[model samples]
Target: MTNVQLGAPNFRIVSTNVSGEASSRALFGVSYGLGMAATQFALIPLDDERTLYKAAISALWTRFETENGVAEGRKLALVNVRYDSESINTFFYTKVTTVVVADVVEFE
Candidate 1:
């Protein structure tokens, strides 16, 4: 694997995660703004569902660094952080598979 440096003060780092829920809700929100109020009701449930997925993704990142011997303070240039999630269960409200990746670039 190629090492990519991450962390430069000049540029802002942005991260995003895409899921079925987010996509559907985002579309609904956009449509609602365009005079499609009916979609908003369907999208509300998605908003709640996505929050749990987001939390899981965050925890996964925290655990990744801990398990991979990566120190949080280490200065590395990372760009284009992305994450994806999928539901694994419906009953009992416990199901999500999250995958995250980032471009690590050398800053110094």
Candidate 2:
């Protein structure tokens, strides 16, 4: 029998949803690993929550890329994204801190 060797995967999984429900099912042979981040922001009551949430995710992705030295064209995939946040109320504004932990994968 000939020995078969497997190479790197051609694709990766990146999802913002839990349960992998909104992601493509196409199979990839390999994966990187998980990444976690804590992002904080101070906002007045009028600040947009949705926008900040999106920013937090973006920051997390940036952090992953910087730490991993991932190539520019390479894509970052996040799955099983678990998010938690805490709010500290102050006299002038609220400080919101978020922690995001996910199954992070890097692929071409």
Candidate 3:
């Protein structure tokens, strides 16, 4: 039960694939908890829908590091950093967001 930090060169991107099934990438290295969330608002019917959610998740991770100081400027390892997205339809196409939550851990 040891505490680990982020920013450590412990994680590495293994592979990335985009297809009809699912677009995702895999990372190899240590294990750690990396939680993320994304949100977006759309006005026009046809527009770039991926960028907004990506930005949101990025911001969420940044904030998590800044606030929790889990892996801030430290050699912490991470693996299998996955990304997923969903839509929230209410009144109108107002917003969309995505969240990625993972754990960074090292095996003994």
Per-prediction TM-score, please?
A: 0.32, 0.46, 0.36
Q: Write the per-residue lDDT of candidate 3 for residues 1-108, one digit (tens) a residue.
A: 866555555554322221111111212211122244443434444434455445544555565565445555554344455566554445543333355544444332
lDDT by residue (tens digit), candidate 1, 63-82? 54554446367554445655
- Candidate 3 has an lDDT of 0.41
Q: What C-alpha lDDT, on a 0 to 100 scale, does residue 78 get in candidate 1? A: 40
Q: Which candidate ranks first by lDDT, i.e. highest?
A: 2
Ranking by lDDT: 2, 3, 1
RMSD of each: 10.7, 15.0, 14.4
Candidate 2 C-alpha RMSD relative to the actual structure? 15.0
lDDT of all predictions: 0.40, 0.46, 0.41
Clashes counted in candidate 2 amount to 0
Poorest 10 consecutive residues by lDDT, candidate 2? 19-28
2 or 3, greater by lDDT: 2
Better of 1 and 3 by lDDT: 3
lDDT of 2: 0.46
The order by descending TM-score is 2, 3, 1
